[model samples]
Target: MHSSSSSGSRLSLNSLTFSLPLKALALTVALIPFHTINASKAYQYDAVVNNNKLTVVGVENPSTVFKDGQYLHGFGYDLARNYADSMNVELVFTTVPDDATALKLVDQGKANFAITTTSIQNIESKKLTSFSATCGDLYSLQKNGLNTQLSWVFKHADDPLTQTASGFVCQGKQSGSISQLASFYNRNVVQAESWDSIERDLTKRMPIYKASFQRTAEKYDLDWHFLAAIGYQESYLKPDSISPTGVRGIMMLTNSTAKAMGVSNRTDPAQSIQGGAKYYDLMLSKFEEVPYPDRNWYALVAYNMGPGAVDQIQKRISAQGKDPNNWVNLYSYLDGNKAQNGRYRQAVQYVTRIRSYLEYIKNTPQLVNI
Candidate 1:
């Protein structure tokens, strides 16, 4: 196993940044791939939503909906889009600062469901709206493979970073029972900084690294955004970075992983990127039937948790009525892998965040077409 065995430290979705200014420009689009029932749709859509012009109130939550001013994503966006399409409506999306505001909009009938973890508890107090099926969840891994029992005391339904409930704060190697505890007890835990610090440090370096990403991605016929996103996620595009588990360089390759891919220096940016790309392609080859986008998403999960882990999840997905090759459906199935203890969730976030960043890169003026 790679040195980064501890799931908490390695699969830290809490570390993903959600800092982006909300712009007045509501693009009215659906970015994710869901079918549209109509062909006579209107015109001039930015994101990629339904046709009925449905409006939704939300917050800048990348965990559920990634709002980057130009585009809105995640379950909320997809839900609204699908609902609108089902009803033949167009999609309109908005973001606020907190969950109370979002839920209030829904409670008052100003928009659709609040569609957030925060909204879950607050809705009970309001009578104008009803909470539907578990719209979404804030998944946090106590540890990798401790025990996939989702039985933690899911207190603090809104705050997940401090994920503590009934004095059960999860720690390494002793957390396999967390999910079981949380589930039996019937609860779910809920859960950035930087200034120019991240921007200033990464500004100049992004171009050089993105160029590397482009080259490596093309060499393998892979999506440049994906290869780059993995590099960015693995080491924040830092060629010299090292992970706690001894993963090194921009791609965060473990020593054995690196050597197996013919990489002599895991710290070298080009060597690491290319090697990581090769490894990723190898993983992608495992699922030949999955369509694009979803296929890429599955491959990314394989890159993180191993193909065996992905295979197990896909098997469960197939067992369910959902399509195992479809990422969006498969993603929901991952949550059902109660035995994996949120490792699947880690992969889900890993892919979601990377795709969002890829979208961000495409929208960025300086970084476009790199």
Candidate 2:
């Protein structure tokens, strides 16, 4: 069945709902060098249509919207092109050095529109026309930099560096990619630390692991946010993290899974994130019959409790004529088993924390579905 959304509350697609609220705990601050920029001084968020014929956008990640040998590809690129086609306007792609420059271009009428992931605070200050949409596939990994984590950054397409993976989404709105992304996560994460602690120490290793997470998550056919949530749940992203049970490194994989994923050293951030993503990918494959989001939960539970344990539950659910694919149904079975309930709670909290953080980055404070 196709679904639509109300304009006041949503854009063009069905809303994504992950009901989890995690308390942002008391964090211990640590400083990490962040490559940050502000668009407040550079451009306004309002749509400045100096010429109806031209729609100029500022771009940071050109791979997202770029032309390759007469073929156009990228989420943002396609979005801009499609929108322009709908409006019967000419779309011009321009190179922008920074947010300030992009905003300045839009403000000075050098460009009709500037597209970048500029913070929301700056956008409001400038009162620029925002499409009121952002790409859910894009991730905002700010260090423990509160008041600095970042908000309201829109994506631009046509960067030569972005992967043209023959990806096709629901064909509308910023959430298209994000909705697809939601299919890759689950609620079976082990919550080892408070949100506050993760917040405080995030900056320390975020710079180190963020790129690796993105790279590995992409390779494993998962969203970076899913792996990131797991990383946070496992060790708060501490590269040197070692659990009491001896699960090692950022993604906290046991030595067996790590070695199987081609990780020689679990303590290595790159190895850990990549290995963990691969392991989770395998878990996802184990439950292909499950639906999205719920499928993600199944994958997560399997990741936490191992495929063997989850397989037993699935068989029992099937034997009882219950749906083995629905997370809620599967959870009902788990809830009845006292031995597994403890892990179920941890998984819920795990997914909740990650989803909450991802939701914040996906939308601005004004539009966040909290």
Candidate 3:
């Protein structure tokens, strides 16, 4: 439940009552501060209990603490978050360059502890630091026979925090929580349930409307596969498809959207594809501050939630000190005041399915010449 934020002027939650238009919102840079750990013994317990912050440092490893888009995710981040939660403290993660730096940070008392994906012995062999560990049983020896187990490296061998971490790690392992977290975070999350249908559609239906997607996307300066992915997600490339809400056709355009895009017929496959591409391009134009692929994702979300709501949410995110322009960061805040639980989940699934479909479309060979 720990979230990172950029340094900015803090805004009062009371002032965020009105919805801000997309064009009027300001963007914040995503930055992780390098916090120096307090060296006093009196600060340790007081910092965790009174101050309520647990700062830890680690290197970015895919299976450990890598950054995806604007947010930190992976096993190390989750483990550290859980450890902080056990102590009732907010987790503050700082990224180092390598395992050696991570261990050094802990040994020099710069961080409370460090999470290592490799063996403690490997790091200990090189650094003269007297670091001890509490977690590693979740992993086995590497194929090369080196111990590649994940562990937490703390400064003092007999610190109270170290012992508590040991107990937590042991309990997590016993409960299969550690292994489950590792397995879930390390998997290919991009391959979703919609893949099979997308595959089937690529062969059967995509060839029929590929030219329309390409022509409209090129006209709008967009990726044809991106347009086609939206097409598949909207109507599964069915020209006659209609939603319960009355949006219909290949791209499932609403009557208003169809007319705005100059489409005469919502059921006309080419016109619908043209309208969808044009509308997505319009969404793309609104998120210029967001970087390429993430901007594309924001546009996709805007397509679902509308640009005004996306703008309002982004403003709320900025007021809380997180970067609003990054989709991963943006997505992390979907459980908003407006839609707390299930409705928020559907919005997340929409972006995920479309993103997977976009990747699938990009990889699949084009069957028709544009």
Candidate 4:
């Protein structure tokens, strides 16, 4: 009886050992389809290795990146193109709203890169991939100097040699030469140093010489830079630069316009700038219904030719079945015998200049001071 019991226990132990392998085999069989499905679902992005096709993403701001119908500019646009060229890839851009969103897209593999005055911080560096080389820092070199350090300068696109630098790139049709006029930057090319200097310069120049003018600009909710840009265009910031067309002072106020604005002295820098700022504010208000890009162009035309001319252009633009407030669509209607005159021609050129200048400021940290 003892021998029979011992044999029964041994038989039971053998059955349990055999059942373990069968369970494991069943589990293996159950997992086979899961493994196969996972393998089939695995996806790979079509990334160009060492190829020049890169997708860059950034914020969609006028200062960052904007589309004027089909035309595109701004530092972010230029930089993406440049970097792609360096890598021999065609650049594709996707515009977002802010840096945090942009970085998130990159991390999620929606875009390969992000560009928009991106600052490399410790936290950010660990979170996402960035260029080994720092980009978007603005610097200035002495006029006529050749130090590979990029500097910001205002130049006509038609100028002979187009200056393409780190932060600012000019596209123009003229053959005139360009020279840098200021060395407001340090030799250090790091992003931090460059950004710091630009902020410092901008702060120092933010205070307009006249407190009243500053107050008025604030009251009108106008950017002091837009006012400054107007001053720069009018007289190149020269308090006494007078146009051959009878415009005077830094604001380039015509005698009639000045008198209308109640400006007693068009030659006084403070008064002229204030008068110009006020006039611009009025023009901006008059076209409050117009779309942006167009509104800016209209304000410029009003500055150059007169509000009457801008109204005429709007009528022509409307007659042509285009939106009068669409600057990109309306600009073509402004050319030729219908509006062919030096005044209109100058207005066209001035609009382009202001657009480029605004683009330059938006991209380059160095020019933020202006």
lDDT of 1 at 345: 65
Q: Which should have the higher lDDT, number 1 or number 2?
A: 1
Query: Candidate 3, residues 57-161: lDDT per residue as tens digits?
Result: 777654455443335544566667666655656778888778877777676766777777656577676442232222445352232122245667776544556
Select the stronger candidate by TM-score from 2 and 4.
Answer: 4
TM-scores for all candidates? 0.50, 0.46, 0.51, 0.48
- Mark the regions of model 4 whose C-alpha exceeds 4 Å error after superposition: 1-56, 59-214, 335-340, 359-370
The candidate scoring highest on lDDT is 3
**All candidates in order of TM-score, best leading:** 3, 1, 4, 2
lDDT by residue (1-370, candidate 1, tens digit) is 0011101111112111111112201111222222542334222121122333555555654334554333444433443443333334455666667767766665454554444545323555554333221111223222221112212111123221111111122221133222322221111111124424534544667778777877988888766765766777778888899867798989998899899999999988889999999999888688777644346566778889888987877787778764567654555555555357778667656765576555455455665543
Which of candidates 1 and 4 is the stronger one according to TM-score? 1
| Stretches of model 3 off by over 4 angstroms after superposition | 1-197, 335-342, 366-370
Once model 2 is optimally superposed onto the true structure by TM-score, how far is the C-alpha of residue 205 displaced, in angstroms? 2.6
Q: Report the Cα lDDT for candidate 3.
A: 0.61
Residue lDDT tens for model 4, 1-370: 0000111110011000001123433343344343433333212122533443566666655334544323344434543444343334455766666667676665565665555445556325635434321222222222212133322111121111111222122211011101111110111222334645544543454344435445666866655545665565566566778878788887888898899888999888778877887788788678777644346556767877778888887888788875677544344444443365777666656665555444434455545433
Off by over 4 Å in 1: 1-196, 336-342
Q: Candidate order by lDDT, highest to lowest?
A: 3, 1, 2, 4
* Candidate closer to the true structure by TM-score (higher is better), 2 or 3: 3
Task: State the lDDT at 145 in candidate 4.
Answer: 22
Better-scoring candidate (lDDT), 1 or 3: 3
